[model samples]
Target: MEPQLLHTVTGQVATVVIRHPAKRNAMTAAMWGSLPPLLETLAADPGVRVLVLTGEGGTFCAGADISTLRGSPLEAQRLAVAAEEALAAFPGPTLAAVRGHCVGGGAQLAAACDLRFAEEGARFGVTPAKLGIVYPSSATRRLVSLVGPATAKYLLFSGELIGTERALRTGLVDEVLPAGELNGRVAEFTGILASRSSLTQAAAKEFANGRTDRDAHWEERARESGDTSEGVAAFLERRTPRFS
Candidate 1:
């Protein structure tokens, strides 16, 4: 069987490719099943500073592999929930490099990431409406967290695939680059992130995640942490922080 998840480290940056391009990179249950452990491996490696998720070929993802999703509805539910939870809780920063079709569970996976960089031709949608399956609540929350409740409702209710500009207007993507520029831009962005102090990066992710839910003292406490002090000092001295 072909491996569903492909992981490799290039210096401080880690790359994960969903390797089913023969099917527009649609994820099978097994693919989703393997992601958490792979992400955990990167998370535990102190050497890894950044993670990027992409699909082989020009497509980002076409969502769930409904071909194998036959009569086992309960099994399908379990897999979907477990798959999304794994991505949602992955430690360290992650970016989804998107190009062609990004629909259904593929969109959920991207929604789990900290950032999404889409190619100009990328199309995004939450497609449970067409599939007759409910969009899991956790996935819904993540989508709403990105683009607000109304926009989330719009995508969920309509099963509509949107253009890159519409996605950007709704904050579904951080950057949209031309197809020729997508790979290089993703490398450039993650390269910058890789050079930042990991301790600061991890702490900042935690702090920002809390801020979205209206966590109090998150900012104040983070600013008081040793990592923050080191970051400020590094900036003042025009040097990189050596966060321990």
Candidate 2:
């Protein structure tokens, strides 16, 4: 089958699946380029309260298809960075549901999400060193943020893969589950996220992503959103909050 990105929505969760199983879901140049626009479309949809990124079959993504780099490695790296940035900037909650190998560009994509949940056997690596390519500065900072300077340097400098236990311990992954339980857990978590107040989630995401100037802006949104009132009313009435 041709390598492609597949999109599907169930309830409020939108999923983007990377499909290139013959190469363990390695991204083609076109696949990398397609991601930003696809994310933009999903972000604009009011029905999309959450996004889940994963790979078809088991492997998340091996990296950019190495053959695509023959023309210009720099260009491929640029495309990957753009896609990663877009994912990081997504307005609502985003999660990466990972299994098998999530390395190189795959790790980049997963890192861009707000949360990552992996299966026990999943392996993660940031492998530019192996290819003798400089990893992007933004991606480097993000890695440091997630795993701290020591772990990020260990992965980037050595290009070695880490198992789920170390990954969760170092904060590279938020949760690690057994083989058959990953999908169910991701669904449960995302459903809870989808049911929360969007106003709160949006503001928290921006603040967590380092937008310090948005405090006043989010305060205004909260005042106008009616979610606060709805939440209090629901609490008093002993019912679920109907957050618009």
Candidate 3:
């Protein structure tokens, strides 16, 4: 069967599932091409507050579909890079709920996400070295930012897969859960994110992702949003803050 990128929205959370189980959810060029527009559509929806990216079947993405590499390799790489950029640039919080193999381009997609929750058996690697290809500079920078230059170099240079424990220790994954607990934990966390103030989250996300300049309108926007006041009121009333 052909590879597919499937999406669904439930309340404030949107999920993008990589479905190519025959190749361990390996991403095809077409799947890469589809990502940016899919993310854009989700971003435009006011109801969607967070995105969850995962794979169907037992495993996460393996990498670029090697079959496509025999055709237009450069185009496949370009599309993959574009998709990675789109995920990295997503305005809202994004999480990767990973299991099994997440290697090469799959690792890139996970790195692009804000957080990653992985099953204990999950494996991660960056393997362009094995294929005699250059990993994109943006992806390299993002990987370095996540796990530092030395560790990033270790993975890129060796093309060796690491277990979930090493991934967590290296900061590649935020949390490690049992295979059965992964989805529930992710849903629980995203629910918390969705219930919080979007304005605050957006501002924090921007600043945390290396926005050095002060956003001049931040204070004004915050004040107008009334989130602080609502938060304070909620605290006093001992009720959940209703963020619009």
Q: Sort all candidates by TM-score, best to worst.
A: 2, 3, 1
- Stretches of candidate 1 off by over 4 Å are 1-3, 211-226
Every model's TM-score: 0.89, 0.99, 0.97
- TM-score for candidate 2, residues paired by index: 0.99
| Candidate 1 global Cα RMSD | 2.8
lDDT score of residue 172 within candidate 2: 98
Candidate 1 per-residue C-alpha lDDT over 104-197 given as tens digits, one digit per residue, 9 for 90 to 100: 8889889988999999989999988887888788888889889999999989999999999999999999999976999899889898987776
The alpha-carbon lDDT assigned to residue 149 of candidate 3 equals 94
Leading candidate by TM-score: 2
* Over 4 Å off, model 3: none
Q: List the residue pairs that clash in candidate 3.
A: none
lDDT of 3 by residue, 51-150 (tens): 9999997898999999899888888899999999999889999999999999999999999999999999999999999999889999999999999999
Prediction RMSDs, each to the true structure: 2.8, 0.6, 1.0
Report clash pairs, candidate 1. none
Give lDDT tens digits, candidate 2, residues 90-204: 9999999999999999999999999999999999999999989999999999999999999999999999999999999999999999999999999999999999998999999
Q: What TM-score does candidate 3 reach?
A: 0.97
User: Which candidate model has the greater TM-score, 1 or 3?
Assistant: 3
Candidate 2 ranges with C-alpha deviation above 4 Å: none
